[model samples]
Target: MSRRAAGVILLAISAFLTGVKYITASIYSTSSPNSGYGADSFKQWLDYVEGNLTTYSMIVLIAGIIYLILAEIDDFDKK
Candidate 1:
């Protein structure tokens, strides 16, 4: 496939994963509807989840870069 098409597919996959994460989190939230305490707890959980997502995304990005670099080196060696 073309590089542009591969990029678009990866982007779409990432978006789909993000949407699923958000929807699942929403469905699992058991916080009270009228309690500020519950809201505070839920907010903390949301913050933690967001932080984790950011960290995982960064790791994945770095891994992809590494793979691309290695692939390029391997291709150059083949010429």
Candidate 2:
């Protein structure tokens, strides 16, 4: 409803998504053969997942944090 509420929702959603991504990546790593010999490694898969999914969520998280900060600043100015 409000900017603060929206920011809180976004923050929660981003946190949830990030947590889900880690769970998914862990499951994926276990199922796949991610040997660190060449290109396929658990770290690489995690990086890929982070780039594909978590990156956007991270951006949203940052945006939400900024929004919260701005809201606090605005409220402080009003008082």
For this target, which candidate reaches the highest lDDT against the unseen true structure? 2
After superposition of all CA atoms, the RMSD between model 2 and the true structure is 3.4
Stretches > 4 Å off in candidate 1: 30-41, 45-79
lDDT of 2: 0.79
> What is residue 54's positional error in candidate 1, in angstroms?
4.4
Instruction: List RMSD in Å for every model shown.
Output: 5.4, 3.4
Candidate 1 backbone clash number: 0
Pairs in clash, predicted candidate 2: none
Candidate 1: pairs in clash:
none
Could you tell me the lDDT of residue 13 within candidate 1? 54
- Residue-by-residue lDDT tens digits, candidate 1, 11-55: 555565566556555554654464344566656556645755656
Local accuracy of candidate 2 as per-residue lDDT tens digits, 20-48: 88787677777776444433565766775
